[model samples]
Target: MNTTINMTGNWKPKLMIIGTLLGAGVGLVTASLLARAAEEGGDLELNGGDLLKTALGVVTTMRSVAALGAGIG
Candidate 1:
């Protein structure tokens, strides 16, 4: 009888877990900042323009992050 273990195949789940944790951490920090801003400004209202701008910024940031390793060797 013979058995083999593929160590290289383990990276996918590890990468996924790291990505999930990082994303969650970022989300928590962003939420904390927003909450602090709202509390200090005493304004809980956000208009459409504000939302659109924030969405665009987030998309741009994600694009930049996605391109991180594209030029690496």
Candidate 2:
């Protein structure tokens, strides 16, 4: 009795790695964009935009990888 959830084959780990890399790339790109703005005067304002962008990236990456996996399987 095989208890595997994936019917595509032994590609679970590889897919996971790809998903992780995708997420990281997205997050990094977002962060870089946010960093483009230089600090003004003396103090810099803190914002949640960067965090939100990274979260979006993670979600986007996951969805993309899931879609790819489904298509392949």
lDDT of 1 by residue, 15-68 (tens): 789989998999999899999999999987889999999899989887886776
Model 1 segments more than 4 A misplaced = 1-7
lDDT of 1 at 41: 93
TM agreement with the true structure for every prediction: 0.69, 0.47
- The pairs that clash in candidate 2 are none
TM-score attained by model 2: 0.47
In model 2, which runs have C-alpha deviations exceeding 4 angstroms? 1-8, 39-73
TM-score of 1: 0.69
Clashing pairs in 1: none
lDDT tens digits, residues 1-73, model 2? 4344554867878867976898699779866665665333444556799669867986887688678656652
**Model 1: how far residue 24 lies from native, Å:** 1.1
Candidate 1 C-alpha error for residue 40, in Å: 2.0
